[model samples]
Target: MQLKKALKSLVPPSLQARIRTWKAERAIAVFEAEWRESRRNAARIQVRRPIERILLVPPDPGTLMGALGDDAMVTSVVEMARARNPEVEIEVLTGRPVASEMAVAHGLKPVEIWESPHFVRDLDALLTKRRYDAVVALGADIMDAYHDFLGSAKMIAVVDLPARRGIPSSVLGFSFNARPNPRLAAHFAGVSPDVRFRLRDEISFERFGRFSPATSELVADSAFVLTPGAVADDLGAWIDAMHADGRKVIGINVHPMLFRDATDEQIATIVQRGADALLACAETARVAWLLLPHDYRGRLGDAVCLEPIRDRVAGILGDTVRHLDGRHRASTLKAVAGRLDGVVSGRMHLAIATLGMGVPALCATYQDKFEGLYRHFGLPDWLLLSPESFLVEGTFRDALARFIQQLPELTRIVGARREAVLALSRQNFTIFDDVAQTARIGSAGQGGSPAPVQDA
Candidate 1:
């Protein structure tokens, strides 16, 4: 629209009116030709690189940052896949209109965004649009469209989370029922012969393996592969100030789910409880707290969902607690998180962003995803499962007390574990490399390190 508008404004009004009429007629003709034959004989441009053009499909769609840490984690799949072959052209295929701000932060710039997501919508159109040697799904769970897209791409569906018993009734096969549904079972069988699995956690591996007990390699969340970038100016200034005071900064991520799902009164209770714990810990220990809201949603389109809670914490803690919400990219958030002394959050990916960088974190919940990841990080004791009720149980203060007192050990453990996980995460790329090298989907003989398309 900007390009068209600018071009039009440069022409005289009288000439432009006539030009528009003719341009529309010509555009229709071009559109018809493009529809009929644009991609028909389009030569499959191949190269010697392990992979060529890659399509990344996220499980659900929203502005990437709305999913917060999830955006960084999913995009890490693109980063991981690209690591196998840096020159590979990458595109994000999702329902939301992708903005490049998130991708740019990771030193990766997507070539294009295929509309919508796979499954019921754009899967077929996108597959037919380009010959993708590889298609990777970022979300943990296995969806119904898993096999279809996997078979269409002639590769694997990377399962992140497993279909636990009775929890998710939505995914086709794994219902609360005694037996797996036959139709979904048939769909499950559609996985291509050449496919591979990079299951994020053991539970996902175990549950998915029940169907195809073949070789599903267990792995940690892809977020571990993301390296932090330089912190932004404003956040950097705050960190520097705290550093001048000789105070260690701890990131406090309050997930929107904490309040969005609760009533006003419940929200106040949660805020008071969380703020109380943070203030006690901060004032007593002489540490600064950075309020990081991983998810920004609800009223304003770009607003972080935890504004109310952030406001509450800020009101009490004053300048000691500052909120990081607006326009901060995932990479920026991760960079900020990497600087934190510790973290307490309800979100998984935020914890991943922090913990993956060797920062000690006490998650608000001990869920399956965290458990699966901590096993790989070798810091299983670092998390507290579902700590929402911890305040009421009078366990919040004591638990945090323990986390604070043992900060040195926690830091050492996380730093070593992050190094180990990063090493292991690199191996996750081998599956894509093997599949692409053997499949050899693109045109041949073009080598010598194809221009670095990893990022702009």
Candidate 2:
């Protein structure tokens, strides 16, 4: 069964799509069709055409929700790389078990995983034995730790989100009265020339560009390119029932951690506001609401907030207001979200994933990362923001009121802009492919000396 599924990936993408539709209709009993859906979405865009060998280095993984998010990000990157060069041989030097677990959840198989407690030794051993065409550093600090082992591989550094202390002191250069960190300068300086660096957004690009020695470009977060797979029939039945009653479904996801700093009154106010917002929307707009939990793990996960909100809203809407069980994976949440009319989430990744699926989602963002993404989607006002504001009396109520007003238009806008948003995401890897191929050509074109991992 696994081999048959694996062989399916080798078929042409158009045929694969048709095959999936045919299989889905026939109820062919495929165990993990969503994984195949993700790959099909991936095949729609590529940066190069045929990368022979590529190595991806991921950061230390987190628990369920975070891990799934990271997997989505990495998978998007890998698919983008594959788009650049079709039939590329890829390996994720998978370090943490969390990441590998996510790989299983996503049904991305034939993964070449290299795991070890001794990361440095394992990394060096792998690189020393295999000559990869390119090495994509998924995290910023990977170079600092593994500088010595890269050898001649084309190194592509991706500048990830929520950048810390941008415009590294090294780029300003030594002034008569000012000096930069030698270590920072040396690390970036040692990058193999022709190395391509990608910043997740324009804001990060502007912040990181001056310090980077390699050509840097702006690209959408890879998560925006991933597509969700199918959900269980039981869940589907719930969605069908909701729609059958002629009530549009609006999904709500509030991160429990959002209430950590709030007072008892403030927390209650926020929850009440969410419940009230649902009631108001349902009454005015003729809709039902579901509590969507994007993050499924940890002390203050989505389930924690979702259960309370469900209880609070249950009296108002009864069975019309149900919350999802916390057991579903992130992909499962996304699959269910596809049935929603629109979504309001505090979890940014959920918004991105849902929006990528062309679901109009409102975000309750708390960082700069959120702004760049919403801006890319062409719906800047779709987010309700600030942790501080949630503490202020009536702030959430006011915000929710505004969001309710925008929901209808927001949905239409997302439906219209979905293709453009995806096009921007694909641009990231197109630039990435150009960078990787340049590094590859440079290495071969010049018989380049081994890139020195030394002090600047």
Q: Which stretches of candidate 1 lie over 4 Å from their true place?
A: 1-48, 61-66, 81-87, 96-129, 142-184, 258-260, 299-316, 380-382, 390-393, 435-456
Instruction: Give the runs in model 2 whose Cα sits over 4 Å from its true position.
Output: 1-49, 61-66, 77-89, 96-122, 140-186, 210-213, 259-269, 431-436, 439-456
lDDT of 2 at 311: 87
Candidate 2 accuracy as lDDT: 0.53
Clash counts for the predictions, in order: 11, 11
Model 2, 1-456: lDDT tens digits are 999989987899999899877754433222113212221222111222245666555543222125556556676666666676666666654435765676556443223333322333334345445545555555422232233222111122111100110111001000010122334433344343444455555545554545445445555666676657677787678778978987677788876567555455655665766766676656666567788776656645666566777887789788788777646555566677778877878876787778877787766765334666676667866365776655565666566657666767877878887888677666545433332233332111221322333312
Relative to the true structure, candidate 2 has a C-alpha RMSD (angstroms) of 16.4
